[model samples]
Target: MRARLMIRYILGEMIPTFFMGVIVFILILLTFQALRLTDYILIHGVKVISVVEMMGFLSTSFLPILFPMSLLFAVVLTYGRLSADAEIVAFRSIGLGMPSIIAPALILSILIGILSLQTSFHIAPWGNRQFELLVTKLGSEKPATIVKEATFSEGFFDRVVYANKVNSKTGALEHVFVYDESTPDNPVTVIAREGRIIQEKTDLGNAASLRLSDGSIHRTSQGRHTKIDFSTYDVSLLDPAEQQFRSKTPPSLTIEELKARMKTKGLKKDERLSLEI
Candidate 1:
């Protein structure tokens, strides 16, 4: 009964410290992420709520790194304070062993380590995949949300957009120039007198469509330029959400799926190496 009470006393001293350590470590790690995420929101024009949601997902992903460190700090700090007060000396004078005094901390560490393993092996990858999906959903917005007037906007559907005037409400644009590099070998530059950006919702996700009026498309290939005029033309932008189902990359896959993949015939050397490591 006395040993159990002593263990409880030690645990009471350590658990609060463990939680505090976790909060401090998480805040320190998240500070750098907060700065980068803030920049992403400002540059991409993403909503604050959406950014907050992403941060929540990121916090979950960081647990595997935080847990063990927090437990260690809690154990070290609690024992150090107890030692400073001569608690260890008093316990030793009474014939209690060093291991007896430290047993509570060891048990707590073991429990925390088990939980941390679950976070590392199971939860982290799932959170990462969700984070990626959120990014994809945010990127599928209309060019009007992304483009600043009279400035070159690159990375939209792997094309560059420059518009003299923009109507954010209607997604309308004027004097628009778009350079399409989707086909690296055959590049195309389009100039439009007027254009509008449209977002279509499909079963997959949002898709960006550029509707240009009174435009001329200049295609270049093999040192030759072919120009064509059109009254109206529509072009599709890169949809990040569309790539979600193409393949289950290793990072997005669970342990079960990886084990199943290992059983597949003719697994490449790289695949075998990745699974092994």
Candidate 2:
């Protein structure tokens, strides 16, 4: 009963300190993170709420690293205070073993380590993927804002668009040029006298459409070029970043997925070894 009481006493002192340390560490990290995120928001004219949401996602991803450091700080602070108060000497005088003194910390460390492993391998990766999806959604929602006058905009998938003049308020473009490379072997280019952007809600999601007037489409394949003129044309815009987010690498896979992958065939020996490690 006395041993259990001693362990409980140690934990009672340590738990509050551990939480305080976690708060301090997270604040310090956010201070540096806010500087960069603020700069990005200002330069890109992004919404403040979006930035805040992004920060929350990033903070979630950092829990694995923060948990261990916070626990260490709590251990050091708690033991240092006890040492200063001569508690160690008093405990030794009572014939209590060093293992008994250290047992509580050891058990807590193991528990925290297990939790950290779950966070690092599963939660962190999920947060990272969510962050990428948020970026893609933000960019896709404002396709016109991403384009600039007299600049080659590569925001659209497999296409580059340029406008000699742009009216930001009206989402209108003058003297536009677009190079489309949707097909690897064949390419198309379009030149238009005027154009406008249209954002529409579709079943899949938000979609961007560019409507061009008095444009000529030029298609080239196998060293042959065909040209056609049209009174007006409309093309859909796709966000390439969405594709990248969808095809994340192994680091984004959860612990369960990794185990399943290990059982699958056609994995290289090195790949299986790396996963095992």
Candidate 3:
């Protein structure tokens, strides 16, 4: 009798969380699948492994999307079902009012809110960081995740570099090919035995620059073509670092961080709420 009542109470409290967790988890998994493929559509493209890594990155990226949704769903389903089933009416007939039936639900909500706060502040942030690390490591490894296989792997900013074989180690790009598409009538194409991409912090932000050694370029000007050999050459291109940081997508912050930010935004005048038990 007493034990059964306790079980019913606990069930009433958990109904919302169960529904919310199932729905939220499925939706989040789907979103991660979609975000991971973003790189595949980009010009140079991304590798599948890298894209998978990005999915790992995105799970935390969706913090602002998931937690609240779960909480909201839970509250609505639990309360709506209770009302529809006339459980509230029965409780009220037993000398309990709306407030009494709602008391347990409210307590459950408070517990979820605290859990959500912790997730927002800590768990979400940690996931975001891991996601970033995965993206960074992947991008660095396969700088050109995809490039039509034989096409010139022109990085961002139209700066092109190519390789028959990427040594991968030592950042050396082999069987190198490069084309200056920005050139007006006379596009310069270069081929190198070995090359390297150097990343430097520029005035704008982080960008990739090229450092080619043992390279030769065929120059065409007004239909006249000349081939030149070079021991070394260096050119700067766009690195996503500055712009990429914005896209890296970090996780939700902790409660303390939120408090600090909200303070700047403006605090509420009404700092308290009334509750009935």
Candidate 4:
């Protein structure tokens, strides 16, 4: 019967894909988790607990990306295997047209797409919020939570920033380096005899600044150059946003919620209606 074949197709496409997705998700999560160790340990005083917590948090955030990828891989691999096995030929021999063969797969794809849309809108927003809160809590407890200077570093608000050397002894940012080569911002070298944290609360976002002192400022911008002999300066860390954050769970929400987002923009009524037709 048509119904049985459709059911078979849906199961064939989705199940193996789900397992592959989990494997890919774990691998990606571990890769990022490993990198966090260098910077986290540098600041948190290397500990087993820190590693476990970091891994846990990162994996929570990787689910959304994995779902769509898994669905794609599932459809491709399943159909490929069927074709190679001459299943398509068998179907054709029984009067199965292309549409007939694709019916179940298409239905399954639509279902997965609906799930993905929900994850991105509602579930992802909450997940991202938790991620930000976790990072904030960890950052307050361990300054190294925000310290990402293991390699050529880029800040949330900055394009280029680096730490030539971070003093493990005093928790001081020494040989501290930063280059905002983006033409609009200053191009400068910041040498902090020592740097420490100073937190400030703001209406728009949570803010923290690195207090850099005993440092001179060298700045160049937009066909102008200046050198300022200064005693102190502070670099601000911008606040995290709700929409930009993603959750760790591959959760689902309804289509009504998703359609409220910009992703649904193309689906809405247009001013140029009937013009193309």
For TM-score, the strongest prediction is: 1
Q: Considering summed lDDT, which 10 consecutive residues are worst modelled in model 1?
A: 238-247
Residues 53-167 of candidate 1: C-alpha lDDT, one tens digit per residue: 8887787788888998899899999999999999878877877787889899999988998888878778977887788777657877645767779999876655799999988
TM-score of each: 0.68, 0.66, 0.51, 0.56
Clashes of each: 0, 0, 5, 3
Error of 3 at 219 (Å): 25
lDDT of 1 at 217: 96
Cα lDDT, model 3, residue 3? 34
Runs with alpha carbons beyond 4 Å of true place in candidate 2: 39-47, 144-198, 209-245, 249-251, 258-277
The alpha-carbon lDDT assigned to residue 174 of candidate 2 equals 96
Question: Model 1 — TM-score against the truth?
Answer: 0.68
Full ranking by lDDT: 1, 2, 3, 4
Error of 1 at 91 (Å): 2.3
Off by over 4 Å in 1: 142-198, 209-246, 265-267, 271-277
Evaluated with lDDT, which candidate comes out highest?
A: 1
lDDT of 1: 0.82
Mind giving the per-residue lDDT tens digits that candidate 2 earns over 1-277? 6667778988888889988987888778888888767754764567899998888888778888899999999899988988999987787787777898998899889988998998988998788778767766766676666677899988454479899998866779999999987665788899999999877766667767789999899998899999999999998765343445465546667888888888989877877887777
RMSD of 3: 11.9
lDDT of each: 0.82, 0.81, 0.60, 0.59
